[model samples]
Target: MVASLVIGILFLVLGMALRYWINRRKFYRRSPIGAESFSSYEKSVGIKFIERVGKWIAYALIIFGLLSLWVYSREKNDNEKQTKAVESTR
Candidate 1:
């Protein structure tokens, strides 16, 4: 149970970090263009790359968070069952 709690916390933190990174990347991409700017094609490509990377990171974080929640829930259910069984025997 303790281990599961730790792992769940880690996953939550990791998901938050990934979310922050994706937001930061998007903010950078959307910021105004300076006097020295890349061509339209180059800018488009950069934006596309950032979008793709951000999507992948977001997906990974979501999956990790879900898995952690699943594990925690399962552990809790198991503990509850054990307690009930012990009480019944008593």
Candidate 2:
């Protein structure tokens, strides 16, 4: 449970970070001189790459967090079942 909590927190943090990065990139891209100042195709490609990577990272983090939550719930349910069984046996 502790491990799952830690992992969930980590994933949440990572997702937030990725979202921040994506927003920062978007802000710069929309700036008055952002795209206008870039003369090379390579620069555009790099920006696109960054956006894509950030999106993937954010998605992965979300998935990870969800999976962790599922696992935690399952564990909690199992623990509850065990407690109920013990009480009935007593």
Candidate 3:
């Protein structure tokens, strides 16, 4: 149970970090306040491909993390219910 919760939290943080990195990379790729080169604003095909792939990876990680947490909570609730029933019988 604890492992599941920890894993879920870890995945969630990793996904958030990955997303932040992708956004930051895109933001910084642009030209500064007054740039001389127009090429700085242009995104290469490779960069676009990486960004698209990274975006999907981040989304998958986030969804998997949420699902793990949901499973963990369900297990915890079931355990609690069994414990309560046992106590009531005693």
Candidate 4:
């Protein structure tokens, strides 16, 4: 449960980072002050590349988070079953 919960939290953080980055890119494109920094940023790292990577990463994180939840629940259920079996045998 702890492992799954940690993984879920990590996934959520990663997904948020990608989303924030994507939003930053969009914001830079529109905001005049961001134009200077964005141009340099674009030159150093292609805007298109970040856009594509960000979207894919965000999607992957979402999937990972869901998987984590599933695993945690499954583990908890198994633990409960085991405890019940032990009690019954006693």
Query: Best-fitting candidate, measured by TM-score?
Result: 3
Better of 1 and 3 by lDDT: 3
TM-score between model 4 and native: 0.71
Q: Of the candidates shown, which would achieve the greatest lDDT relative to the real structure? A: 3
What's the best-to-worst order under TM-score?
A: 3, 2, 4, 1
Q: What lDDT tens digits, residue by residue, belong to model 3 across residues 59-83?
A: 9999889988998999999999999
**Candidate 1: stretches off by over 4 Å:** 31-47
Q: List residue ranges in candidate 2 displaced over 4 A.
A: 32-39
Off by over 4 Å in 3: 32-43
As for candidate 4, its clashing pairs are none
Clashing pairs in 3: none
Candidate 3 has what TM-score? Answer: 0.85
lDDT of each: 0.74, 0.81, 0.85, 0.81
**lDDT of candidate model 1 versus the reference:** 0.74
Candidate 1 matches the true fold with a TM-score of: 0.63
Return whichever of 1 and 2 wins on lDDT: 2
- On residues 61-86, what C-alpha lDDT tens digit does candidate 1 reach at each position? 76777787788889899999999999
| TM-scores, one per candidate | 0.63, 0.80, 0.85, 0.71
Model 1, C-alpha of 20: deviation from truth (Å): 2.2
For candidate 1, list the clashing residue pairs, or say none: none
Query: What lDDT, from 0 to 1, does candidate 3 have?
Result: 0.85
